[model samples]
Target: MTKELETKGAAIQGADAGKYELSEEQKAHQQERILKQVAKELQLPLTKVKASVSLLDEGNTIPFIARYRKEMTGELDETQLRDIEERLQYLRNLEDRKLEVIRLIDEQGKLTDELRVAIEQAVKLQEVEDLYRPYRQKRKTRASVAKERGLEPLAIWIMTQPRQGSLEQEAAKYMDEDKQVHTSEDAVQGAMDIIAENLADDAKIRAWVRKYTQDQGIIATEAKDSEQESVYEMYYSYQEPVRKLPPHRTLAINRGEREEVLKVRLEVPAERIHDYIAKQIVKGESIVKSTLLLVIEDAYKRLIAPSIEREVRGELTEKAEEHAIRIFAENLRNLLLQAPIKGQVVLGVDPAFRTGCKLAIVDETGKMLYIDVVYPTPPNNKVAEAEAKVKAAIEKYGVQLIVIGNGTASRETEQFIADLIAKLKGRGLRYLIVNEAGASVYSASKLAQEEFPKLDVAERSAISIARRLQDPLAELVKIEPKAIGVGQYQHDVAQKHLDESLKAVVESAVNHVGVDLNTASPSLLSYVSGINGTIAKNIVKYREENGKFKDRKQLQKVPRLGAKTFEQCVGFMRISEGVSPLDNTPIHPESYEVVDRLFRELRLELDQLGSKGLKDKLQHADAEALATKLNVGVPTLRDILDSLQKPGRDPREELPLPIFRTDVLQIEDLTPGMQLQGTVRNVIDFGAFVDIGIKNDGLVHISQLSDTFVKHPMDVVSVGDTVTAWVLNVDLKKGRVGLTMKNPNKKQ
Candidate 1:
């Protein structure tokens, strides 16, 4: 390692001590590379990718840029923008790591022109690491010891595979007692160690070996204790090819292994790997070929095999985690965007046993009208007494719908409510069971406490249940998106990735539905395009100190809300009684002038928006020609038209309402081929879990999702989807039910 070998790159690295600071020109070059690569991979135009990247770099939020900058991004949606954002971040990180790795290699006097170019041109971080492996500084190892004993030259000489060399004499030349080389055999072994490490660290060799192992390996699992029964009994003696293993099974096997209930192994094709290594390291019948063959075997067994197995396993886990995060994100988006049962007075029941069921009545606007507790199950089954209080509250609060929390004692409470509604006969009342997955988490949250300090946890939960029936997105936003429990293997996946994906899903949904600025809580407001938690709280504080915001422009007066924040968030904040009706619409303030001009061009009053006259004109308006006349792009003009047509509209309202039931069913009552309607509570990679008025949600396996082959469960169904499913089987003792979405009577 000579200091004089240091070059210009090394000098720069030394100046900053490996700070990874790229100059302006370097950053620009890197960004251009990243944008071009993202565009190619995503199949988007390079110009569009560049425009979107520039917007993102300028601090424009994904939701804002997606909704408002369609002209610039060629109509890219939120999903595309987020994909671009993720790619840019990963490539930037890769570029930074490459610079750092290059500096480290150059400092060690090992950086060559080919290696430097390889590192710079690498697209993935793993590739950079692989290229740097041979030059990387090492801890104590057999190879390091061999190098210390001056055996590297002999190793290199043997690698040349000389046709006429004396193996014994060559090995004897390295015999020295001072540095642990005492005999010809010891010298031979030291040279073999050096050669083995060299082969193992070669980038191309490792890459080829890793791919071969991953393609041909089989994942095998067996019981750690065979006699112990477990949910993973099917995996007791299971083996599946790595290429054929599904993501959900991967997560399940990983979890079982983690819990020590199963022993797992990767059964790789050892003979093929050995042959390939021999082919690479050995030539036709050289003098050192026999000794080098032994070196290959030792290297693979001691170094390469284990490393390749771990890399394949890590790759499997990373892919599985990514798949799980995607599933969770899609499910969460659908769950959060479930159609709200608006304009209905709701009675919420939080069922329990000895502690009693908590009841809360909310008006059509989601304001709490009443709250109390009644025991209708088990130890404190106050059937008639509970019915009277519920009936009286229904009458006093004009409750039209009842929402029961699907939690402890839910079935018993549901039966009680069914009987009570039966006694009422034609009272125009109905009850629906709602998934209360995060009600407990929300009840104990600080936001819940601040909203209802005088109420107990269960009471707060009841209110949440009632309010969610009114507006799922608004009420559910108060809880963490992951806690909503719409995901499969959420706890087993990479937590940071899942959290980031779910956060983006929530933000996308919140902006899509548009929040009522005057009424949205800090949680919902924080998810709006540019608002953070602090700004959200400040907006609320400002509202409380002054009053309901009567105009959109008043948002500028709030502390910490500047021009950028206002620009990003204002379009998604709606006010029902704002100074301008456009404030209640999604129309951005910047487009107000064009809209007024549009109204003038149509010869319609501003109040005529959403009226028949505006609809008639919009139906006849030529978007392309009108946009040219209006000096605006067609996409922007079309968006303006859509927003004007549906002022203060919720995108969720267009979806089918959740299935409401006035009765309950038990697992014992489910019979094979018996058809029933249900709502999909969660979708996983394997299938969808449907709520069919039973204690446990029925599982519709992937095979039964459709008659045709289904690629994934999400392609067939999502969270909050309504479908007709037939009961396939029921395990009475285990309280499990299986369902099929295929019709039994349909002919093949």
Candidate 2:
């Protein structure tokens, strides 16, 4: 409340009442309300959510709180904590906006008790905005003009309708030639305008109208040019209820509308909405009934309907974008967490027609040992020379795995590699097709240039491809997440939102898998829980200056890495081949004492971790009992025990490795009923695209995903999954292959 309002309210109440104050009470109530609301929304206990929010407020990263403060959060996963964190910020902002709205209204001397209370009680920003809409300043609106012409009294009298006499005469009393109210009819029209504006600005009325439209509205689309054929053909004559419209369809319609290929509109029931507004505003029959009816109709048609339609469309787009972002984030997580084909000397092949096939041989540690170009495809199809060059490079590097970029000329290059493998005797060489969706983007990036300034873009891309196979998380972190291409409709969604979500997914994946402290690049380290790009670079620079990180504790010595940063990051940065075995595990250093005590109780040395003796001893140990003895929470203690069993474990190790083959299959080789094992390249709303040792990845539609009904393709498959699928149809002309996970012989 403003100082003037506070004084006036105090004087109105009593001399002893003093200045009216509710700030402290309001703050406390809002904070408590936010806690309970977040708890109810997330379906977690209030205490656990409160604790998690407090921890979040205290600067704990989501990964750290989830991993170390499990007892406090009741073992809430990173996803839950992140949701709470986001909601916490939202509710806090809501409170701030409410106060600001109150102050703005108070400044105008229009903040009544009921209005202030409504603003304070509003839970969502939309509700607060609705309450503020009436008081918001207008620019020479019809209502404002009516008020200027002194017709507000006439409008108010019509609303009351106490007597049924001479409505025109009453309106004529307000008419003035000087103000452009030349006739009683003009006077009545101005009054009706006032009533229309009032009805339109009524917050409750607008809210109800919006809800009703969204619940019952139908979204209809028609092709701008019916005869034209386009990808949006399916939606050219589409109609779906607003409530039931799926996210993909919403995005498709939006894209079609943006491209001017489809005309779309929300089909609202006009008669029903008009009746609703009449019921809310109109009273008993009177002389002014027809006049008020005109106002209500004009209000609904001219003022409320258009504004509410925009809001409804915005709400739909917001929800659709959210769903799309969720799918993108989930798909990105799976792709980033894919199993790294570790310990392989791999050769990366970037295929092109005119530029030749770029080749780079990377050793097991991802160090580029050789870079060359092989012209294995037209127009300079040097098949034998390309074969000899690859053979020599493979022989010299002892390359066990070859990663071919699935881009232009990939099929011809694959055939060349397959033929070369056949000609070469007993080297046990195998090749895997790697998704090169963002390789060119990465190669042309500044970071890539800095990393490999001496090499051409294609050569650098080849090196990145090989490194991607070796350590997917490490190499993928170097590229922009959206550019990695594991998402659908990425370009259509809001870029800032998509970027934030993808970055969070990468952070979660990196923290979950943990990074090797000594060998991890700044790019990989930047995704660590509490580390930024600057600090990541500082850590790497420190490593280069001092030596390998002797232990995780040495991370503190890096410039700008403070105690909190170390606390949040150390557990996720493993130091294998370090001073202590616990340093190599996911166990935080704060719990090192607990691990030591457990080891002592088990009569085991730290070096004996992962040994048969340690495994046998811990195999039958009760986590609750051990937790009590170690003075730690059961979840953390259990995690400690699990980590002890598999020191230096990479969680990605358990995921399916990439599909490797000695030979490749042409698109023509695929036939119906032919079963082939393939890697799921990308999972989208409609289907999964799988790479089956061919140039074009085949699509496994959601209907053929299972014998049972599948709600989504992701429910049955994820990116990087290896599954056995049978060919459904092969279109050689279109270079398209359709596949199914179901049995080919099974009847539909």
Candidate 3:
């Protein structure tokens, strides 16, 4: 490890010798400062943050450090560890930008000691860019042309407020026809232009003005064509303080601007900015005072105002994007970790209009046993035939649950299924509207092709929908997360940033509920800690060639899965029937000896691991004294005790289950103040869209989320929550249903 770091250090030195003046020692000190700053920012102890950063730098994954290296990191979770890692990368990038900007200025022969210190001390990329703006290269402008015509000295003289001479007379001495200074007035105008540009470029002045604008500016938007109707109708003639704008509104306004439906601009008070600039540049009483005043106004109106407006807008958009990504990540995490509907025979239906509806039946193990196509809606109108086919399939397969995709013609299909269920009342048949957001995307993917080569696209979609109900995490991992449709304005945000954030959420969810090693597909196994796509496929192939793995140690036999991969992923992959019972729990294999010692101290045999007597014994055991005796920390010992209590326990079982319906309702069936049970389909920034066995999903706005104040909709409900709500309003023309969780008429 030392040799590898030394080689890396040499490579950095060889690459950066000419571009930066800082030595290796100085760079190390700067890095140390950054680490301390990150610790302070996160309100974490310096020691834990430092140790976690070191582990990350050593190529250890976040899941590995979080699970296995608790003693070194003070038991920090994956969220905290990932935050430190991201902050570290950001600070390093900031340092690199500083060095590059310094090099650029030095190449221009304009480096000063004060400017160098300021650049090095900057904490944000915006501050560094503000510092570098003065020396940055520019195309030919009014200021540059004036500098070419020998008016820079005149501008500098006016800036000093020399009281001895007339400004126009001094400017006349520099006028020359050959250099395009045609007259005294022209030369004076050129000098003021130069002064205006300089005032515009001042780093300190720009910073002050930026802060003032952001704090005091009003973001105003107006409809470009007032006659045209749009979804952004509320924003047609809107003005709001920049500081008070919500993230969802910001994204909406940005989209409106991008689509050319509205024109948006930052409105700052001009006189205040002009006074601030004049106070900085113009002195008490001089002939050039008036000229300086004119320059300040021109500088602000022409150059600084437009530039600052763009910067402020960009900053707000960046913040809004970050907030949107955070909300999406949280929603995706909750949706992925939803409890699986296990041990049920399910029938999947993919609804369509022109094409026939696709149906697939899967047993308790999620294996497709039968598939067919039926047309029940639209032009074909074969309702009786479709009902007969579905009924036969359900009876033949003993399907108790029907999973219908909420896509085109879904309500019609649901009504037909509801009628069928009513006829076959004694069979205990129920239906659920499954979120099929990414099912089509997954069906068209290369992985889907590899998994179902003989099935068509729609057939694969039906299977995916069924499997999603059986196991959400395993099936959703096969598709990209952004296509899940739980976020607002997902398309407007930066795609790469959104993808990276959602990927981390998926990783956290996957590690939280360990995968079953023998039953997991390669698509699901690839998400395990330290297991990439290639290694996951290799494990599956090895499992196919040899039989089911009877022990966790058998992972070592798979090609490309070395000691490091095994150590990282073994804790997150479970073998239910493995030789050692600990292999099925969340405890790492390295701590098996500690577990053995624990069992020895408890006087329990290996075969008596999950018995009620063993659970009772562990319930009364002294964890603190046992930890001291076993040479392990309390956290590790507590984790071991937890594992022993419930072997192969899934954490998702603690969450609420999906709502199922025996009858279907339509949009016309909804009435104001009607109470109904529903399932949360998607939770966004403003509200949650709920599936209430209706054609149009109901919207529960953030205001109606609770009896008290709700900061966000997710705080009140989550995706897949079984909630009871009252209808607030209904717009039949628009097909929109408004529901509220707070029933005001009912007593508390």
| Clashes, model 2 | 0
lDDT tens per residue, model 2, 524-621: 99989899999999998999999988788888889999999999999998887888878999999999999889989878898788898888888878
User: In model 2, which residue pairs have backbone atoms overlapping below 3 Å?
Assistant: none
TM-score of each model, in listed order: 0.96, 0.95, 0.96
Ranking by TM-score: 3, 1, 2
Which runs in model 1 stand beyond 4 Å of their true positions?
1-26, 162-166
The stretch of ten residues in a row with the least summed lDDT in candidate 1 is 1-10
**Candidate 2 wrongly placed segments (more than 4 Å):** 1-25, 746-748
Local distance difference test values of all predictions, in order: 0.89, 0.87, 0.88
- Models, CA RMSD each: 3.8, 4.6, 3.5
Candidate 1 RMSD to the correct structure: 3.8
Give the worst 10-residue stretch by lDDT in candidate 2. Answer: 1-10
What residue pairs clash in candidate 3, if any at all? Answer: none
Over 1-748, each residue of candidate 3 has an lDDT whose tens digit, in order, gives 1111222222223354565756899988987999999999999999999999999987788988987888899999998998999788777777777777777788788999999999999988778888888898999999999999999998888889877778778878988989989888988999888988888899889999999999999999999998898998998899999989888899999999999999998999999989888788777888778878888889999999999999888888888988899988888998899999999999999999889789999999999999999998888989889989998998898998999998988888888888889999899999888889999999999999998999999999999999889999999999999999888789999888899899989988998899999999998888888999999999999899998998898999999999988988988889999888888999998898998888888889878878999999999989999999999998888888988899989999999888889887878888899999998878888889988877878999999998899988878887778899999999999999999999868797
Position 389, candidate 2: lDDT: 88
The model with the greater lDDT, 1 or 2, is 1
